[model samples]
Target: MNVKGKTILITGGASGIGLEAAKQFLEIGAKVIITGRNQAKLDVVKKSFPSITAIQSDAGKEEDAQSLFNKVNDLGGIDILYHNAGVGVPPLNLGVPNNNHLKGAIYEMEVNYFGVIRLNNLFMDMLKSRDEAAIIHTTSILSIVPSAIEATYSSSKTALAFYVQSLRKHLQIINSKLKIFELLPPLVDTDMVADRDDKKISPAQLISGLIIGLENDKYTIRIGDSKVIYLLNRLLPKVALNLINPNKYNEKLIN
Candidate 1:
């Protein structure tokens, strides 16, 4: 899993964790292709990193995934598919609990969960035929724990966490070399988080975890704050659940 000389495709690469990953991969000398929904943001990112390949595609859509595969295959085959694009930002501390804004919840699940699945379903084949194929997903602490403000987002990742668990077991029987890794990142200091130090883990640290996951060839990988969740979920599922479920811990958040 030497990152150098590998061909890679990253979804949601215009900004945040995806863009940071693209930069890190470029520094390590990998052939990088980045996809984003926003043309302007993609253009800006492309300008910043002249060597990177920037394509416009919404990673959440099935058609977008298909088009991305076609375009990447045309340029060159892919070795690593990084599904990192996601969205989950709404007002927390609303002074009410179970504050389920139906729209916000839907957006969280659609963008964070289904979006990654769509791309993975499409790109799995392209990577499978190649040597040293791998898929890296960006999950969060909420995936395994709770967040007062990120209820839907956490739930989406939790579902994803389980989905990958099954997917990994199936892939193991078919192809042992195909690696699956999840980054349980802390609150990252990206646009995704505007008011917290928990997102303190740098993109570099996350990329380092990616490399470690590849080198070890481990079936499951967890890094940063999500590591806390993984441990807590195992030894203290109740504790972890209480911390992440907003309505449970925050009285004001309960309706």
Candidate 2:
């Protein structure tokens, strides 16, 4: 879809991919409203990009979603609802178990899965009312191939991916023009994975792929190496699984 002359609402837009996208969207002439849980971060982003609107909202909470809805209403409705708010896995290495780790995993589920659902439900009517609209969910490649160290994080995305697919199918049957797009980005070079030494694509690359995918009417946009990973998982499940969680094959190598 042409991003120009559109009103886009991006959750978790204060930093990382969301922040970068907000900047690009603003440059492309879209009225961008970004929501985050931290007011200070939002304020910082506002100071940096005065054109974009930044509001503090926690996607994991119903009240926050409602408040965001009201805030969007004030901006005259949104043409694009971009679900980017999510939590990364805890820093604990694999094989290390703790009660706090379990809690963190559960929290990831609430934010990564249920939070997106809540916001979607709250914004469905507003989107359906618009002449041209789209819903983009930024899932992960881990959904296709679970990360051993981030089991809950991967699982949450897997569940969300299924929901998005089902929602798309329903929309198709009803002949609704509301577009649904899922973005699978693998190890992006953002704050989420800044400390990692693994190779990662820049946010600019991700956004470029996204725009091209949308323009070509692609339903699922796999950025960078995610496309290869998705194919590997589909054609060679065991191989893909082993590749993602190399530790799973460690015992065999040692043997």
- Highest lDDT model number: 2
The TM-score leader among the candidates is 2
- Once fitted onto the true fold, the runs of candidate 2 whose alpha carbons sit more than 4 angstroms away are 91-97, 247-255
- How well does candidate 1 score on lDDT at residue 47? 84
Residue 214 shift from truth in candidate 1, angstroms: 2.3
Model 1 ranges with Cα > 4 A deviation: 92-100, 197-199, 237-255
lDDT of 1 by residue, 1-255 (tens): 777888888888888788878888888888888988899998998888888899899866777778887888788778988878888856455444544567777777887888888878877787788778888877777776667666667788888888888878889888567778776776677766665444377777877786677677765667776677678889989887765563444543443
TM-score of each: 0.87, 0.93
Show the lowest summed lDDT stretch of 10 residues, model 2: 246-255
Predictions in order: lDDT: 0.77, 0.86
